[model samples]
Target: MTMQDSTDLPRDTSRVDSLEDKSLLLVDDDQPFLNRLGRAMERRGFEVRTASSVGEGLAEVRRAAPAFAVVDLRLEDGTGLDVVQALHGAREDARAVMLTGYGNITTAVAAVKLGAVDYLAKPADADDVEAALLARPDALPEPPENPMSADRVRWEHIQRVYELCGRNVSETARRLNMHRRTLQRILAKRSPR
Candidate 1:
């Protein structure tokens, strides 16, 4: 079913619309990422507003009464967790999602306890963000497994080197002290799930 049709969502379209016209408050320190994500969310039928700092985000939340907020863990002025708390304090129904470049179970669990709906790591695309939002209140999805497990650390390191080299196999191999063929073999074995 469409997210709008989900019974778990707030029922009144007018309310949703009123909030949508003002519904989303996106807080991130990275201006470009915020703009990109805001545009992506807008394309998916959300009305998005942005803030570069926690104080500004909190002000916008108080002013707009947004139904949902996407908050980055690190802000220029403070932690996004602070914004989440303020938003929840102002509007109990407001759902908050934490976005971070650094992912850890400790922070994730703490965010949930502080009233965030869920925590998502950076590099997540629009679909990932949407899926997080569409989850039922009692059925939040488990976080994806870390790509840097012990068994996968070597492969993960190779992948990181490859990315650092802009995905050029030869350059990545040179940096990782591995033959190009070896890097390719490791990559081939560990295709993304």
Candidate 2:
């Protein structure tokens, strides 16, 4: 979960009004995660539609724009931003959330600018999704319960740069101003908890 779970939020009887349409589009390349999240959203009273690629998601939006969407940032075919853009273009009031395992500022900003209500890291729970979807537009989201530590954030940044550098240690080190041997050492270790 990126922030607080739905349980942390107060039960709003009027939430039904905001969720009147109840239709949701979920796009993710991960089959198991998609299935699980789809089922969970169904349990939460949404009419869930699942798509595994950007093309499929765009097709679904063209057929019928959903009231809400939870789209993965990186799909097998393309980025989920395409889906979010189509959803908003089809329905101006649609609320979208972008999910990414490779969470970064650039994509997050792009997603929000494209009309997503929130950006969440992957492994987000159903409750977290619900909270984001149902949240009031004027209100701020709750802080994450377990935010990444400084070390973890640094590690993640390094890892992201490494990947961007095509996993070339020397190139990554040059970009990050780190020693090649030190970069290799960091990459060799497991991620911090």
Candidate 3:
């Protein structure tokens, strides 16, 4: 991997030719994460389809089954399991991974049983997802080269809660047991490292 500018960007490369029909579906209610991951998947040679909710995901599945999928565990309209079930129904070979910030054994088992080949926690990058989607039982998840620091973890948790509260500072503060002013100050700053 050669540096392309200071960012250490990799050269555009693919294991398969561009003509390979590698359709992938991604469903997550978080718009920013969804878009970023979708673009990353595209760069990795996938024909990406994105949706933000179960209904939208299912609709896309009906339109065409994807060979690979990444689904969020929670969505505004319904659970990601719904999307996984729909995909499994439409395509026997669909390789799907379920992602969640709140992971538990029950849900993990349920997700795998429902059709997801793998389950990942939130903050999983594109590579982790791609590996899961293209599952090889012998392969293992590569640890993040740049793991989030404590401050970054706090910032991300607050942001997730705030988004859950519809971005209402007071509501988020109340839920997190933080002063409104402090929460606002934190939100106003550039996220911590």
Taken over the whole model, the C-alpha lDDT of each candidate is 0.78, 0.90, 0.86
Pairs of residues at least 3 apart in sequence or in different chains that clash in candidate 1:
19-23
Per-residue error for 158 in candidate 1, Å, reads 24
TM-score on alpha carbons, each prediction = 0.64, 0.76, 0.63
Best by TM-score: 2
Per-residue lDDT of 84 in model 2: 95
Comparing 1 and 3 by TM-score, which wins?
A: 1
Top-down lDDT ranking? 2, 3, 1
In candidate 3, the residue pairs with backbone N, CA or C atoms under 3 Å apart (3 or more residues apart, or in different chains) clash, namely none
Model 1 CA deviation exceeding 4 Å by range: 1-22, 140-193
TM-score-better candidate, 1 vs 2: 2
- Taking every candidate in turn, the Cα RMSD to the unseen true structure, in Å, is 10.3, 7.0, 10.0
Error of 1 at 142 (Å): 6.0
Which lDDT tens digits does candidate 1 get at residues 1-193?
Answer: 6456567775633122333343788899899998999999999888788999988998897787687889999887888888888888888887888999866555677688888987898877887776676566766466566544664555555666676688899998888888889778887884333
> Could you tell me the lDDT of residue 102 within candidate 2?
76
Query: Which regions of candidate 3 deviate over 4 angstroms?
Result: 1-19, 137-193
> lDDT tens digits, residues 29-94, model 3?
999999999999999889999999999999999999998899999999989999999999999888
Best candidate (score: lDDT) = 2
